[model samples]
Structures are given as C-alpha cells and as structure tokens.
Target: MRPITAIGFDADDTLWQNEQYYRLTEQSFVDLLGEFAEGAHITERLLEAEKRNLAYYGFGIKGFTLSMIETAIEITGGQVSTDTIAEILEIGRNLLRHPVEKLPHVEETLEALNGEYLLVLITKGDLFDQERKLAQSGLGDFFDAVEIVSDKNATTYRRIFSKLADGPERAMMVGNSLKSDIVPAIAAGSYGVFIPHALTWVVEHVEPPTDAPRFRQIEHLGQLGSVIEAIKAA
Candidate 1:
C-alpha cells in the first residue's frame, strides 16, 4: 500500500503501435515461403526460430528478420534461394523504418503525470531500434529516464525502481504484457498495472496475477489516474 512515486511505462504496443507491424511482416514472411510449407506451418516455424534465437539476437526487427530467414532455410531444407533471403531482409528494414504511431491517451496521460511522478520508459528491444522509435514518437522528453533493456525481469525492475525512485515499493510499472510488465514488477514489490493492447506477441502473453494485491488492470492509459488514486487511497 505504499504511495506510488515513480511510474515505469512500456514502449511497444503500450505507448504506440509496434506489434501490428511485426504481425504484418510475419504474414509477409509466411507468404514468401508459401511454396515450401502451409501458412500455419510457416508461422509456427518462424515462432520457433524466434524463440530459439532470442539469446542469439535478443529482440526487435533485426532478430525477427533473422528468424524469418532461419525459418525459410529450415522449411526449405537449406534449399531456399538468396533472393527470398534478400526479400526477408527488406521486410525487416521496412519494419525498422515504420512510423511510430502513438496510442490514444498516451500523450495526455504522460502530460498529466509527468511532473507529478518520475516517469521512466522501461522497454525490451534492440537498443538502436528502441532509441529510434522513442525519438520518432516525439514523446521522449516526457520521461525522466529511458531504459532500453535486453529483457524484463523482477531483478531488472528492482534495479530500475531502486535507482530511479524510492525503490520498488513506491513504483508502478504499466504495460500490455502480463509476463514482462506485470508479474515481474509485482514480484519486484512494485505496483503492476495492465493496459491491454489489441496485438501482443505470443511470447509476451501469460496469465494475469489477479490475486496479487499490487496488481491492477485498467482499460487504457486514460484510466490510469483513477487507478493511481485508488492505490493511494488503499
């Protein structure tokens, strides 16, 4: 029941559009390899490649692009042509260059809470891509700090909260992913707020910690103020 002081936000799909582009590119990937396998099989293999390559490539468009190529090679039994590989690379480049579209209520919510709380952007992705997206979003200045990390975990939340605020007890982490944004933050002793997005990566999906006292779910960023107030009152 500690009063929330610092607020951590997730960038992809939380503040703006991200996963939709990935989904689109993934469909493109599936189509490019349609000769080798069915769309569902291609998609499944791509997901497997992505999961296997996480430790190798981490996250973001670069990893996704590589996974597409890997899946192509796997599906085609190493007979996939270089032309298809080039096309997959172009798909990734397009993803990197896609426009950053802010979600509704993102700016107003940040503007409303900016000076009142220590607002930090804690996200997981390729460092360069994340930086580019943040700069392009034009929402960078609203944050007191920006953390583009390799992954999100309880230890990561604990370190960030302790370094940026009055520790995890006074911090609240908000985002769409139950796995990265909510459970870990709650485990770190911070208030965890869920703001669901229409498209979330399969890897990021997990069961919500509804029974956790520090866990909360809001319809959107616009409702965040009320949740904060409720937490404060509690």
Candidate 2:
C-alpha cells in the first residue's frame, strides 16, 4: 500500500453510535403495532419497506420513519390509528434528538492524525440530519472538509478526489460499509480501509471484494493510526 495524503472517513457507525438508534426505534415500532402483527413479521415487513423506499426517501431517520408508517399501514390494512402515526413521527423526532456517542478511540485517533493528513468527512445521508450529527459529535474541527453526499460510489469518490491536489491515488477511505465505503474508493484508486461495526444496517451490506488491490481491515478505530503508519512505511 502507498501512503495517503488525504483520508476520508465515513460517519455514522464508523465514528459514532447510529444504527443502534434505528434498531431501538424499530423495536419500539414493533411493540407499537403489536396488535397488528408479530414483532418478527413487523420487522421483516419494515425491512422490506425500507429497502423499497431507499431511492425515494434516500437514507436517514426521515426515510426510516416514513417506511415505518407505510409498513404500519400495509400490515394493518389501514387500520393503524392516527395516534399511532403521530407516535411514529415522534419516534423519528426522538432519533434526531438522540445524543451522539463517539465510539471507542474516535477522538483519540482523530487527534493523533489531526495535523498529519488532510482529513475529510465523506458521509451520505440527509443533509440536515448529518450536519446535526456533526455539530453534536464535537469532532468537526478535526476535519479539513465535510461532505454530505447523496451517495457514495466510485464516480463520487473520483469526483471528490479530483478537486484535491493529491488525487484518488494518494487518498484513502475509512468506513464500516464494504459496499459504499470500501469497494467504491478502492475502485476509484484509493486505499479502502474497512472497520467493521457489529450493528450495521442490512441495506448497507455487501461481501468484501476478494480482489481489491488496495484494501486493509482493522478490528477497531484505535488501530487506524498504526495502519496508516504501516502504509507509509510500505
């Protein structure tokens, strides 16, 4: 692996606790609709709705809330009450108000690499929601740039790198999702670093590519500094 001058980090599960909120809200959703169907059935249907609505609503709490309401309507055959719908909206609002909890070593790792590299936060989700999280995270000042993109793809990665002096060949992407963060950045000629998170959303998943030319996997964010050191040495 070659040295990277610019490093992009994915937000959400990579830096802070995010998906756990979704999971918790989902459980609440199931309980709210307990009279309509079983928790397992509601969960399965909600997942399906979320996947189906991805294109329309994009990603984040707003979309998830809509999907939950849709699923409630579908499963209950329109028997879902207005009060339940209001409760679903409240659930979403509660998610947006959820406190940002930085994962282990997030602040320390960022501090370690603070002035050593050009750090950019490349995350995809609702613009307002992402901005809110960043503001709440207290790690915003560590980043040289912040990009809240509509999607993360090879073309998107290339586009982001194109504006940088070092370009994609001298950049690296670190994130939890194999499909969004790892594969696309690797395909775009940057080193892709995968930091697996246990509570990743199902829709963000894909098998890690077997033939990725420049890829690294570390157990935790605390190991990122060492990984970068090894890359520089290589």
Candidate 3:
C-alpha cells in the first residue's frame, strides 16, 4: 500500500448525522400521506420518486421536497390537497434548518491528521445546504479545500486527486458509501476507506468491495487515525 499523502473526507454520514435527518424527514412524509397509503408504501414510493428525479433535479433537500410532492400526487391519483402540499414543503424547510450534529471523534480525527497530510472535504449535494452544514460544523478550518460536487465517480475522483496530490496512488478517500466513495475512488487509483453508517440512504447502497486492492473498512471515524497510520507505515 502506497503511503497516503492527501486524504478526502465525505461530508455527509462520514463526518456527521446526515442520513438520520433525511430518515426523519422521510417518516414525516409518510405520516403526512398516511391517508393515501401505508407508511411502508409511502416510503417506497418516495424512494422511487427520489431516484426518478435525481437526474433532473440533482441531489439535496430541494429535490427531495419536490419528489415528496410528486409522490403524494401520484399516490393520491393527483388529488392530493393543497394543505398537504404545504405540510410537505414545511417538512423540507425544517430539514434545511435542522442542526448539524458532527459524529463521534470527527473533530479529534480531523485534528489528528490536520497539517500532517492534505485534507479535503468531498461532498455532493445542494451547494447552499452543504455550505451551511460546513459552516455549522466548525471544522472548516481543518480542510485544505471543500468540494461540493454534483456527483461522485471515478473520473471525478481522478480529477480531484490529480490536483490535490502527486497522484491518485498517494490519495485516500474516506466515506460511508461504497458506490460513491469507495469503489469509484479505488477505480480512480486512490485508496478508499469505508466507514459504514447505520442509516445509509438506499440510493447509496452497494456491497463492500472487499476484493479491491485499495479498499479498507473501519467501523467508524474514531478508527481513521489507525487506518492512516497503517497506510503511512506501508
């Protein structure tokens, strides 16, 4: 394993309690549409709507809000009421205003690695919302840069690492999603560290790439220092 000179951190679940807020908003959507369908059915439809709208609206609370409205209309056969629509919009607004809760050891781990290696925050979402969370996180000073991208893919990782380090071989990406964070980074020739989250969004789900040469999995952010040390020792 080549020693990692630059490290990229995925902002959402890797650094803070992101998915849980989305999950709470999802439950709120189900409750709002309880009259039209069961909670499980509503949840399923919402996920479908989110996936369907991903390309058109991209990701974030705004897209999610629009999808919920669309799902409500579809579930109720276009007869969904104005008041319900208003409530759903309120749910989204509340989510936007929700407090950011940094996960365990996030600050400590980042502090440990700061200045020793290049640190960049690579997160994909609505720019405004992501920026808001970063400001709220108060860990902004630790990162050498912040990238709020439209997507995460092999090409994107390669481009980012090219500028951030000597090469992809000297870069490492740590995040919760295998599809977005691990597999693509590994494919781009960077090391990928998987830190699983209990409530990952379905859209981000993929089997861990245990066979990948550049892949590593740690249970949480608290273990990140050890992973970095192991990579450095190699």
Candidate 4:
C-alpha cells in the first residue's frame, strides 16, 4: 500500500443515521393510506411509482415526494385532499433536517484524516436533503471536494473519480454499505473500506466478493484511522 492521497467518504449511514428516518416515514405513510385510501394499496403503488421516478429523476426527496403524492392519488382514486398532500409534504420537508445524530466515532475519525489526506465527500441522494445534512454536519469544511451523485454503481463512481481525482491507486473510499459503497469503488480500481452499520437497507447490502482484491473491513468508523495508517505504512 502507498500513501493515500485522496480519501472519499460515503454519506448517510457512514457519517450519520439515515435509513431509520425513512423507515419511520414509510410506516406512517402506510398507516395513513390505509385509513384514508384503498386497503393496503399504497405500499405497492408507492414502490412502483418510486422505481419509475428513479428512472426519471434519480434518487432524492423530490422524486420520493412526488412518488408519495402519486401513490396517494392512485389509492384514493384522485380524491386525496389538499390537507393530506400538505401533511405528506411536511414529512418530506422534515427529512432534510439531519438533527446531528451521527454514527459512532465518525467525527473523530474524520478529524484524524482530514489534514493527512484529501478528504472528499462522495454521497448520493436528493439535492435538498443531502445539502441540508452537509450544512448541519459541522464537519463539512474538512472535505476539499464534495460529490452528490445519482447512484453508487461502478459506472457512476468511475465517472466521479475521472472528474474529481487523478488516479485510482491513491483514492480509497470509506463507507458503510458493502454494495453501493465498497463493491463499486473496488471495481473501479480504487480501494474500499467497509464499515458495517446496524440498520443497513436491503437495497444497500451485497454478498462479499470471493475475489475482492483490495477491500478492507472495520468494526466501526473509528477504525478508519488505523486502516489508513496501515495502508500508508504498507
């Protein structure tokens, strides 16, 4: 291993808790739709609408909010009231407030590596919500570059690296999701370090590759410092 020149990070569960909020909102949506709309129809309709909207608008709150609205209309036979729409919009609006609840040791580990490496934030999501989370996180100044991408597949990451950094060898991605964060980065000729989170979404988990060449796993975000150190000394 050589000295790490560029260190990219995955947001959401890596730096802060995100999925739980979505889960809570989803449960609320289900309960509300059942009470006002058709029986148990909103969940299926919302998922389908979200999938279609992701194709058009990509992953983010705008698409999600639209999908939520579309699902409500479908379930209610276009009878959803303005009050109901306002309530749903309110939930989407609150999604942007990160509330500063962070993953364990994310701050200390980022502080440890900021000066030594070219710290960058490489995250994906809705523009408004992702930006709000970054603004709330006081750690934003430590990063030299920030990328809010549409997805974390290998192709997307390759394009991001092409535009942002010079070489893959010196770039290592530190993240929580094995699928979206680790697998794609490693596939793009960069190293990846995986830090498992307790409530990883099913969409973000992948099977461990049998032949991953340069992948590292850590118990928590605090261990990232040691991983970088070991990589540096190698």
Each model's lDDT: 0.93, 0.91, 0.91, 0.81
- Residue range 43-120, candidate 3, lDDT tens digits: 989899999999999989999999999999999999999999999999999988989999999999999989988999
What residue pairs are clashing in model 2? Answer: none
Cα miss at 33, model 1 (Å)? 0.9
Candidate 1 lDDT, tens digit per residue, 149-215? Answer: 9999999999999988999989999999999999999999999999998899889989999999999
lDDT of 4 at 99: 82
Clashes of 2: 0
lDDT of 3 at 198: 90
> Candidate 3, after superposition: displacement of residue 79 in Å?
0.9
lDDT tens readout by residue for model 4, 132-199:
88888887998988998888887866776677776666688888888888898899888899888888
At residue 136, candidate 2 shows an lDDT of 91
RMSD after CA superposition, every candidate: 1.1, 1.4, 1.3, 2.4
Candidate of highest lDDT: 1
* Candidate 4, superposed: residue stretches over 4 Å from native: 1-3, 36-41
User: Higher lDDT: candidate 1 or 2?
Assistant: 1
Segments of candidate 3 deviating more than 4 angstroms = none
